[model samples]
Target: MVHKKESINRKHFLKDVFICSLGAYGGPEAHYSVFIDQLVVKKKYLKEEELVELIALCSILPGPTSTQTIVSIGYKMGGPLLAFLTMLIWALPVLIIMTLLSFLYQFLNQNNISSTGLRFIGPMAVGFIIVAAFRIGRKVVTDKITILLLLFSAFITYFIREPWIFPIVLIIGGIVSIVTSNEKNLWTPVKLNPQWRYLVAFVIIAIGSIALTFIWDNRIIHLFESFYRYGYLVFGGGQVVVPVMHTELVQLNHYMTNAEFLTGYGLVQGLPGPMFSFSAYAGGMAARGSGTFVQVLGAAAGGIGIFLPGLLLIYFIFPIWNKLRNIKGIKISLKGINAVAGGLISVSAIILMQKSGFSLENILVTIATAGLLLTRKVPAPLLVLFVLILGFSF
Candidate 1:
């Protein structure tokens, strides 16, 4: 009996470690395997079908599907503590890497090592942005109206040279959708936990900001503020956040040159994790001239600022989501938002394509990639590898 108990404890320990590691990697597949197996198979508390339903629900919601999926799973398995643990695990790697990179960039900047790299970053960045736009457009635009909206928005944005145009378009699109469609109940408040979660998130953020302020002596507060605000306000996905981050970091704070920022953006597109990791690159550049500690501190602050809002939003909104799930107006509003989201992505793709210098080779590569993505069971990383090889050879 004693031997069996020890073995059981060991198994549990291993299982927890595995789950935590998987959680640290924060992707849909990772979340599915690690959290699902642990919660359903090992715990044996929830049904498989229920787990599937939960996954589907998370998939439909905006934001990182994997993070939300894991959060839901953790909530089911062990309430708020587990949820926080799962989120922290998923966020840790990027945070650490970004922090380190920020420190390195700061050191390099002090020695003027960044200038040489900046030149090559420009054209590459344009290409990257174009690719991003193409990726988003291909996924979002299905209908004629959405296509029109995308084109109109793109033209207005390019011509007006205004950043606010995007949000204005979204709002107008939402209102137009409500007005034109014969659907009832077109607006719904997101379901949220009591204000307590928001309070907790705010407090945590405040403490972090204060701690960073004291530690780094507020050297890069602008960068920190921009990231924090962007993370908090950004509603759509990674692509939507791109423009906002760009405007703030490149245009507003002047932390990074356009070329440098674009290059970092391109690199991020090729990475496995969230686009928010771009914060690390930006923060690192911004902290140039600072010592290692300052660099890491800046990167961590920027990265956290970028992601904190999303985390808080999810925490606050989860409970309310359950309550509003059955509301008719909420359903209609979601449908409209989904439509607008699709349109927004399409617009982004067009902009990116123009910037990427789409040639026959790239077009063909994109089509092939799209086909693979739509039909084959291959993973995204593998697909990216295949395209990279093809692009290199062609």
Candidate 2:
């Protein structure tokens, strides 16, 4: 068992986080699988149960679920400092790639570069989600009530497909678990000394940024406010946030064309790490007036702005999570929450598979990817590289 408060090696933990970032393609659902493979299974930094709790907690909160979940793990390992570094290491590379891609979009267009080489990534991600669903499902689905809760959540989310549905379903799952369970004396109050300073900082930045946007006619301030708001307001993951961004950046502000925004999004899909990194591309493109430096600055603003609130929330809440979990009611509810989370992952694989197409080759790639992952034979990065090569070669 990994002990909290510096019992773990900070460097090694950060290195494993970097590895997860490199292999974390797709959105949050698929990203969770990569976390499972690398952090829980391979590294044994935390047990599968702890990871599931983190996932459920992050899902209920706003911002990037996978990113927040990993940060929570970092928080568990070595507190806030390590958590900050984990967030940076997990997201910085892809943020950089997305920022550069924002500039390279023109070059790619000029060269008529085909994105066919990224064709298999979607299917490969589905494979990861499938394995994740299976593994998490086996652990979470222990009883009839839990099974029903899982199915109910999966069915609801699959059909609804909205940002609000996720938290609502998870809340319902917890409530149902509590109502139906036969446990007595579930209320045990533990003192929670939450760090209120972090929450105050979160609110101050949010309000201050908005106020600054109105007071000053600066593009960077406006971009930071916009992206920061997106960080806290949007639920689910990058997929949900993208449309809000498109509407604001494309339709409202005319920062870039729909084509440009979509192009950057397409590029982000092939890159590993948080989908929120697409904000860098959009912010850079939006700030495209003075020079490359200004654009890069905009990208920096975007990357930091979008991730900051979530980090702050983690800072405020995660310290008390263990205390909260000590309540027998909370512990009982987690079973349902974890099962519902598993169902969400399961449904994601189906949704992604439909989107990627049901072609024979796609099916084969997904099956092969899942098979390799299950066997623990091929490393994720190597698997990703091999798939990219196949996409490029044939």
lDDT of 1 by residue, 16-37 (tens): 6345453433124444676556
Query: Model 1 — TM-score against the truth?
Result: 0.68
Stretches of candidate 1 off by over 4 Å are 1-65, 102-139, 142-144, 160-163, 185-219, 342-394
Off by over 4 Å in 2: 106-190, 325-394
lDDT (Cα) of model 1: 0.56
Least accurate stretch of 10 residues (summed lDDT) in model 1?
Answer: 1-10
Q: How well does each candidate superpose onto the true structure, as a TM-score?
A: 0.68, 0.67
Q: Which ten contiguous residues of candidate 2 have the minimum total lDDT?
A: 258-267
lDDT digits (tens) for residues 225-318 of candidate 2: 9899889876556765654576578756889865466556655756789989999999999998778899998998899999999999999989
Q: Which candidate is the best by lDDT?
A: 2
lDDT accuracy of residue 377 in candidate 1: 64
